[model samples]
Target: MAAFVLRTHDYRTISRCLESYGLAVERSAATWPQRRFTDAAERRRAVATVTALGEDPAGTESAGYFHTRLHLAR
Candidate 1:
């Protein structure tokens, strides 16, 4: 099972990325949202693909999918 404990903003970005790739990303309604990749190979592939897209400046991701500005303490 693949689970990610990240900021809601980050998860939304990742969800969009996964959906754009036509991958079914399931989410849990629990306190902490959960995502699972049942197949090891598929899991790795998805991670790799998403990582690459996140690093691309040409895409909506624009070199990073994370929105850390909000997480920083003012």
Candidate 2:
């Protein structure tokens, strides 16, 4: 599966990116949000969307394990 590290500051951009990929938000975390894809095409689209948004995509072998990091400017 594909994973990504998205910054909180870019949440909106990422959300838009994911929407572009046709993946709906499945859940959210305190620092990260999770997205589920219905198929491989959606997964690829999600990865591309996040990558285009400048987030680093990390591919993992773990089932239902997508992790991301969030940062806030002080």
Candidate 3:
């Protein structure tokens, strides 16, 4: 697994880079049914679920984070 820090976090930007590198990217669907919770406990639980899926919590304040894996031909 190779990890690279991207200068931009836009999906289109990432796609363009992958194309330039001749790499095919398979994107996973985002976790759904996100509900705004009034209780802190509920929010924590939802954040935990997102974390388990390797995604940042929706409540996070920052953006432009990208993580991807590339497959190699044998």
Model 3 per-residue lDDT tens digits across residues 1-74: 23332212225565667667777655444322323455666556545654665566543412212223233211
> Candidates sorted by lDDT, descending order?
2, 3, 1
**How many collisions between residues are there in candidate 1?**
0
Per residue, candidate 1 scores C-alpha lDDT tens digits across 1-53 of: 24443322346566567677777666543222134445666445544654554
- Local distance difference test, each candidate: 0.41, 0.48, 0.42
Least well predicted 10-residue stretch by lDDT in candidate 3: 61-70
Model 1 spans with C-alpha error above 4 angstroms: 7-9, 32-74
lDDT of 3 at 20: 76
Q: Against the true structure, what is each candidate's TM-score?
A: 0.33, 0.38, 0.32
Q: What's the residue-level lDDT of 18 in candidate 3?
A: 67
Deviation of model 2 at 39, angstroms: 0.3
Better of 1 and 2 by lDDT: 2
Query: Considering every candidate listed, which one attains the maximal TM-score?
Result: 2
